[model samples]
Target: MGLSDGFARPLPTLVFAVAAALSMAGLELAVKQIALGTAYAVWVGIGAALTVGWAMATGVEPASPLKLLFIAGIVGCAAGLKLLPSGGSAAED
Candidate 1:
């Protein structure tokens, strides 16, 4: 989103660059404590949901009940991933 907007304005381009760098740094730190797959999925899911929510809130995108529901689902799933026990065996005796 910022990337697309950045094409029209210069400030957004700088903001996008900074945001991207911060996001990557956070992800790198997250992987140190969380499983790579879980960390990545949660990261992407929350990011996407927030992006869409922001677009809708800002009137850049049309808001719909279905879209809101999906966004809630993404957030819920990310929360679930966070709740799961870390480094647990798939099978137990």
Candidate 2:
């Protein structure tokens, strides 16, 4: 599907995207402030729980071990991003 299919009007799409980003960023900061270690783990666990909930809500079958592993990879990357020193940046992987 194309972007046009998703948005009959641009304003609603932009508004929704901003709202979603703000909410998720708040969650991330809350998790970070609660102690990054425990917070990060809780964030990963919460992410997995949310993915499972999303699949069920959308009537998708529970994925297999390989798929779960791939999902874990993504969560791991997010965790890795948090682990980098506050001012640290990277070039290419």
Candidate 3:
């Protein structure tokens, strides 16, 4: 569901509401075990990409070359976030 009509309609509203709640719980759990930046990046990036994919699959939105490229970009950014080194430097004795 798109932002404007996510909860404006009845059926989709319930579905989206449940999905959002689940996503929040997952984010909370992830933050406890990983860096906040990493967790947040993964959360938002994956969520957005999945939402786009779902929309396209359901015919709610049309799939175009540019949209596919954007999906790729989002996944790439999430990967980059996971690969980046944390700020903590190695301690020397």
Give lDDT tens digits, candidate 2, residues 13-61: 7866775686578677966555566566656665675557567566675
Each model's lDDT: 0.85, 0.63, 0.85
TM-score of each: 0.81, 0.41, 0.71
Off by over 4 Å in 1: 1-8, 89-93
1 or 3, which is superior by TM-score? 1
Alpha-carbon RMSD, candidate 1: 2.4
Q: Model 3 lDDT vs. the true structure?
A: 0.85
Question: Would you list the rank order by TM-score, best first?
Answer: 1, 3, 2
Candidate 3: regions farther than 4 A off: 1-10, 88-93
Model 2: lowest-lDDT 10 consecutive positions: 84-93
Give me candidate 2's TM-score against the actual structure: 0.41
lDDT (Cα, tens digit) per residue for candidate 3, span 46-74: 99999889889989999999999999999
Q: Looking at model 1, report the run of 10 residues with the lowest lDDT sum.
A: 1-10
Q: Which candidate is the best by TM-score?
A: 1
After superposition, which runs of candidate 2 have C-alpha atoms over 4 Å from their true positions? 1-22, 25-49, 56-59, 90-93
Ordered list by lDDT, greatest first: 1, 3, 2
